[model samples]
Target: MFFHIVLERNMQLHPRHFGRNLRENLVSKLMKDVEGTCSGRHGFVVAITGIENVGKGLIRDGTGFVTFPVKYQCVVFRPFKGEILEAVVTMVNKMGFFAEAGPVQIFVSNHLIPDDMEFQSGDIPNYTTSDGSVKIQKDTEVRLKIIGTRVDATEIFCIGTIKDDFLGVINDPAAV
Candidate 1:
């Protein structure tokens, strides 16, 4: 029979692994931490759920690799339903305007705008109401709606509409 030593009973044990009891215990402990950290680290920096291990290419946009158990600092933004909130117009497309409402981002669709309006050729699409009146540009200081999302995750997505009382200006979003 081979000699064996456990040092003390206050230790967790694994089947006699490779060699030393101490070595086996250390490996076992390290393995536990690795597994736990890896599982907990798979998440988005923003609000979200149903996490999947992100691919290297998914976050290769200059953000270095995230080690397991991300150092997360939690902040919450609460928006009430049907409330009119002001935000800076960040992106404007034919479809709508993307704005930053407090901590959350929102989208405002053009259809929501009253009477389609006009901006530099491609700035705002030509919007003519069914009544044949030309739509005014709702493209400045855009007030938007807390519409919908781009994806269905725990992280909330927002949308806006110019048809409502929302307004936006033709400007860069990051400037705000």
Candidate 2:
């Protein structure tokens, strides 16, 4: 799931950046420092959309840098349990397969796959049905439900399953 929320941060600006165009410099620095960063509470910060408020700068006694309380609107991606998402298969092995949904990495254990599908090992490993109709391999797009989530300070990992109806392979890159 993606969310557009307002967040606050204390941005420190150097004495040299206190002249004209300071606001632009601060905004650019905020984008560089905040974008692509993941927090346990907010998931992954996708983009810094716009600035909401910039509070008065506070100057320290000795340090030449000034700290400003900044509030900004941004977009974030957060996955939750029971959320169905379409992800691209990145790797396949006997144990299971790894898929990526946006910035989140999902692991689908072999047991979570349908019972009718069997794992086949080869130059291009894959899981396929007995009839060879449905195949899940590298670059395959699958619809899976997130069973669990592990949110780290900087990364988000998920356990997913494709055993339910209407879930599983959505697109095969090889078939294209």
Candidate 3:
């Protein structure tokens, strides 16, 4: 889920950015540094909303750069167990399929798919029901419930299932 959160960070201002537009420079730098930065605690930092406070700058001994304790509001995306997410299928194989929900990668094993669906092999691999009515393939949007999650320094991986009712393909590109 996406959330608007307040976060704090120490920002270093270079001597070149010490002029009249220091606030603008600081905000731009903050966006460059914090945006796309991922942490185990806060998930993925989406955007910097507003600056709440900027503490007094402390100068370093060797460098003229000033460090300011800045508190800012931002948005983040974090996934949790049992959360239902709509993801686009990226790859399909005999084992199962891989889908992406934003920065998170979700894996739905064959064991987790509905029993009525069977995996078919071809130039365009897919999983389809016996009657060929329901199908999951590349670019298909599926609603899945996350069964497990693991967050790393650079990536978030999730194990998902679509066996339950109302938790399967929401949009089938092939059907279009």
Best by lDDT: 2
Q: Going through the candidates in order, what is the number of backbone clashes in each? A: 26, 0, 0
Which candidate, 2 or 3, has the higher lDDT? 2
- Give per-residue CA lDDT, model 3, range 128-160, as digits (tens): 999999899999889999999888887678899
**Residue 114, candidate 2: alpha-carbon lDDT:** 99
Question: Cα RMSD (Å) between model 2 and the true structure?
Answer: 2.3
* Cα distance off (Å), candidate 3, residue 72: 1.5
TM-score of 2: 0.95
Residue-level lDDT of model 1, residues 47-114, one tens digit each, is: 32222232222222354422222222222344444556667666655665566755456766666665
Candidate 2 vs candidate 3: the TM-score winner is 2
Whole-structure CA lDDT of model 3 = 0.91
What residue runs in model 1 are displaced by over 4 Å at the alpha carbon?
Answer: 1-75, 122-140, 147-151, 165-176
Who is ahead in lDDT, 1 or 3? 3
In order of appearance, the predictions have TM-scores of 0.39, 0.95, 0.91
| Model 3 error, position 73 (Å) | 1.5
Model 3 ranges off by over 4 Å:
171-176
